[model samples]
Target: MNRRHLRWTVPAVTVFVASVVAIVLFTQVGGSAACAAGGSASYYSAGRNGMCNLGTPAEGLYAAVGRAEYAGGKACGTYLDVTGPNGTVRVQVVDLCPSCPAGKIDLGKGAFARIGALSAGIIPVTYGTTRDPQVGPLQVKLTGGTAYSALTAVLNNHGNPLSTVELQTPSGFAPMRQGEDNTWTAPSGAVTSPVTLRIADMYGHQATVAGLTLGPKDFQPTGTVLYGGPSPSPSDSPSPSTVESSAPSPAPVASAGPSSLPPAPKC
Candidate 1:
């Protein structure tokens, strides 16, 4: 064996891989995202209120993420399957714990008990989001909207962290900005009914929920799932809604990256 020849091989391969990652992070538009993180976990059972500002809880299992994972409400409504000493339990990002540091979650009492002992108060945990989780139809809570003010929607029932939320316009689909509470705020436009929304989750799944109506302060439900698993039974929905999946346009780029490349600018 030629030790001298093999000496540079491993380092060369490593450099190539790192360069490729740096290039992709700086250049690519959209790609699959993997959200694995090791962190400490604690339980919170007070307020039931969340930074999400969604009036009703999306589902039973939920948690409050720290500032790092919260990413300015990006983690809101996204389900996380956390594995602890007890087992793995899925939870929604219902709130934010500003005091909680990176890689930490203040899980709900019920959800925390499912994964860890209540007496422990806190425990080490690992958590991440899956690609195509079984999720219910889309629900939108429209509020802070009027003829004078543009409509704000706090979308619910997302299986993954949503990357893009847009509305159909005459010119094209106009993008909306996710507010601090995870509500996507509309641009300066008419908030008309029979509305059409184009959304993309982090896992590269895109779907259109058209023939949908958005009224001010309305918690409307649609018979649609973002992708994967199974469709909710007819009994689950009363609306005549349709969910159509289109070939995703370039998919949502995974914002996760190695702790290199100058660090992602905070949102």
Candidate 2:
């Protein structure tokens, strides 16, 4: 072949290859950005606990619950299929963490689980939430006084209940039993100081409240004091019969000590 012709052929092939590579790179970048900016999803473990920050609200909301598993350089868990008012979506635990009050992942309701059974605390799960996780220290609340009382946490998904609750403390993670009044009470005295509560729905989604915090002072040791319950009814509103003029004996509210997990600062 002539020298000029050979040079032209080589340069033409190089340009074509470069163009293809650029197109592929652009597609990959766009996909990644969508996944990262996407709304909330959560990951949880049977025994591990830590926070999963889902960034801001602009991201959609979802929830998921399931046995946590590990996958290609990431954490994963499955949630019960969910069908929300919007539509159906399958969520995978992409980058979230299992916060205290284990077993539940944090996610917006939109991206986790099949919708119908989202209200149940524990349900068969097959999906999970995905997000870049942020793990923080620990927080605790003590209520009733370490005698033998139950513990509870009111989870709000942006001011709504998450349908499930987790009672966590330095001792261990205990699943709270749902009570008649939207309350979750665990077997007495299973938790102590340095407790933190995290919750997720059957669909593997976390509550959307501004914050959910649990501590030693949030539970009691002897009595069946309430931890979390329905919003409130004037009929049951702290009637003198249900409440006492003086605080319970033993650990007074004043002794909870300086909590490390201060109430999550105002949003």
Which model scores highest in lDDT? 1
* lDDT for position 16 in model 1: 35
**Candidate 1 residue 111 C-alpha distance from true site, Å:** 1.1
For model 2, the local distance difference test gives 0.28
| Alpha carbon deviation, residue 77, candidate 2 (Å) | 25
Off by over 4 Å in 2: 1-145, 157-161, 207-267
Superposed model 1: Cα runs more than 4 Å off? 1-37, 46-49, 55-60, 216-218, 230-267
What alpha-carbon RMSD in Å does predicted model 1 have with respect to the real structure? 15.4
Where's the lowest-lDDT run of ten residues in candidate 1? Answer: 1-10
User: Whose TM-score is greatest here?
Assistant: 1
TM-score of 2: 0.25
